[model samples]
Target: MKKAIGQILSGNMLSKALGLLREILMAKFFGTGDINGAYRIAQTGTLVPINFMTSDSLNSAFIPLYKKYLAEDEQRAAVFKYCMFLFFSVVSILIFSILYFQSEYWVKLMAPGISESAREMSVSLLKVMAVCCPFYLCSGLVNYISMAHGDYKPMSMRASAQNVGMVLGVVAAFYSGNYLYLAWGFTGSYVFFSFWVVFRAFKGEILNFPIRLETKEVKLVMSNFWITLRPLLILPLILQGNITLERALASLISIDVVSALDYARFITDTVVFILSVPIAFAGLSEWASQTPEQVREKIIKIYYWLALLVINMSFFIFLSARDIVIFLFMRGEFNEQSVMATTHIIQGMSIGLWAQVVGYIFIKALSAHLNNRKVLVVMVFSLLSNAIVNVLTYKIWGAFGLGIGNAIYGIVMFLVSAWYLKIARSLYPVIIQISAGIVIYFCVYRFIGGYFNESTSAMLRLLVNGMVFFLFAFLWAMLFPFYRQGVIKVMTRKRLR
Candidate 1:
């Protein structure tokens, strides 16, 4: 189990590193321009449905069901695959048809604050991106087949392929001298990558697309869909509340506000991908397999350490936002103003990193227990809170207001979910660790600011400050009785030669 955890973490880390490099290149080339905003909206529109159908539903439903089928009747696995394929094919066609026909209206609705040129560009990009819907739906089914077989290597490689496609699209944009060609490049990559996964699945004999669906298989699929719908019905309202509000409100801001928010969000998500994905993949399977007492013990043991890591990293990034943005992105059309705007948004978003970690973990833990209804309820309430705050504050605060609302929503969801989990005993230690980490970070930031000019490179300042803060926090944790015991156990476990 530990080895499996290590493999998952390693794959996640590798994928994140590749994604980080891709983002750096993208920021340097595009910044927060009309073109970039159009691309972002197009990509978001393309991915939203895929995320809903596959990630949101498949992870929670398909894996468990597949496992059950394998345990009870292994031969039924083929029937399950064919049923899922048929269902996904029908759904994807319907969704894609609507999106293709409604592209213009969606462009007007999603980013009405942008110029006519930007809106038209967005519509064109959305049309191109829509081509990937069927491909993604098929690929998603292949992902489940591979995962059910206990072979995550193919899934990891396929993920890398998707990133490769993004990199190729950016390269095409850089040299093609036309955005349409770049958009086509993006569309082609998704097609190729999705087909690649399908081919691999077929080669392994783990996937078979049936020409005719079985009645019993169809009923089973419908039952699973209904079970999934119990959560899906409320999920969009709960999950998209903040995002929908952000886009709508940003549309009311300055012309560039929407683009700026997207850029900042891309950066913030990069950080989240780094921290959250590995922890989730490593922890979820382990938690799922553990006894209740064992799970509780493990959660308590790791919660404070994870909290400390998030707080320290958020502080480091917040303090170094300006340099990081300027050094990595202040080139070509991405000028000084773009850097300043993006940096401000990054700093604002950093405030919520700890909350995000807690909320994400809670969601995963809840899902493991198949308590989707409770998760949906919490998400709905969080969405409502986000919508109210974003609508009320966005006019006064601009893009930063959107960031603040996101952070607040995360903290609220974490608190609410923690209550649902009945884990108050774990919260006190986490609160103390976070408080100490924040104090240490702020004190260091002030001292560094006194000696160093603001003109210093953001990345350099962040690196130095991060090292000092981490050292202080490490020493502090080593001295505290509870943390000291954890450190001693970890060291002893490693040193048992």
Candidate 2:
């Protein structure tokens, strides 16, 4: 499991770095301009449905079922795979066709505040990007197959390929200063990497071409998918709606506001991906296989460490949001005003970043237990919270209100998870630590930041403050026996291996 985690973390780190680099290039070239906003809206519109169909919606049902078949019979597993591949492929094609034809309306619906030129441009980009939807579906199934076989390398390589394509695309767009070029680059990524992963899947025997679908196992697998789809897989669909709501609300404010919200939320997601996603990936299969009691124990331990991660990372992000934004994005067209707008959004988002990341773990655990109804209920409430808060606040706060809405949703979702899991007793200590960490981190950053001259570079100030906070936090963690034991245990296990 540690080895699997290491692989996921390394891959995620590289992928995120490249993704951030691509975003930086986009910001440098486009800033919060009309084209940039258009590009953002187009991409979001293209991806929300694709992401829903390809990611959690498929994987939540696919993984456990695939694992089950693989455990019982490889032949059965292969048959199940073929059927699903056929089903989603047809769905993907149908959806992409719809999006391709209705791109104009979708773009207008997503970003009504944009000018006619930007709206038309977004429609063109959305149509081009819609072609990638089927590829995404294929890649998702192949990746899940790799996971079931305990071969994570293919997924990592696929991610790397996609990021590379995106980076190159952004670079090309940077030179051309054309949103059309950027759209092509985005489409070209799915075109290239999907084939590459398909090749890998074939080579690894994770998938076979000319797949046979008419097998007895097909009915069983389809039934399982139906059952899983109704409850567990529906979560991502609702979450996607929440995302669309946020973007739509932001668009009503201004196109620039939409881009700013994306930037801020992207940064928050990057942090969450780095800290929580790999762990969740590594632990999920084990969690699924465990008895309820064992799962509960695992949840406690995961929650404890996750709390530590969330609190400390949120503190760092809250304190250093401006510097981070300035250092990474304050270049070329991405000017001071863009930085200021993004910084405010980040600050508001930092408030609930912890809840969001932790809630992800809770969702995964619940899914593993086949307790998807609870997850769905929480998500429904979260979406409602997000929509109401966004509507109420956006009129007054603009993009910042969107951020605030996300935070509110995150908080509500986390509370719901805690209530359902009945973790209040174990959660008390973590809450106390979070409070202490927040106060301590704030004081340390302020004290260190106070010494810096006004002319000091943002990078230097960020580094100095970050280093000081890290040292203090390290010492604090060392003083705690549980934290110390965790560190020692991991190190000892690695050394022994």
On lDDT, the candidate that comes out on top is 2
Per-structure clash totals for the candidates:
1, 0
lDDT per residue for candidate 1 within 1-497, as digits (tens), equals 45544555666667666666666766677767777777777776666665667765356556656666766765566677777787899989987886789988877776777788888888888888888888878887787677666656555565566667777778778777566654675667668978788877778877754556568866875686578557746676456445655776776775456667766776677666556654554455545556656766666556777777777777767767777777666777777777766777777778776777767777667665566787777777777877787888887877777777777777777787777777866786767766776786688668766435777766667677667778977786676777888888989999995
Off by over 4 Å in 2: 208-216, 440-449, 484-497
Which residue window of length 10 is worst by lDDT in model 1?
Answer: 277-286
lDDT of 2 by residue, 298-337 (tens): 7788888878877777778877888999888989889877
Question: How does model 1 fare in lDDT?
Answer: 0.70
Cα deviation at 472, candidate 1, in Å, is 1.5
- Full-model lDDT for every candidate: 0.70, 0.79
Error of 2 at 44 (Å): 0.6
Candidate 2 displacement at residue 212 in angstroms: 7.0
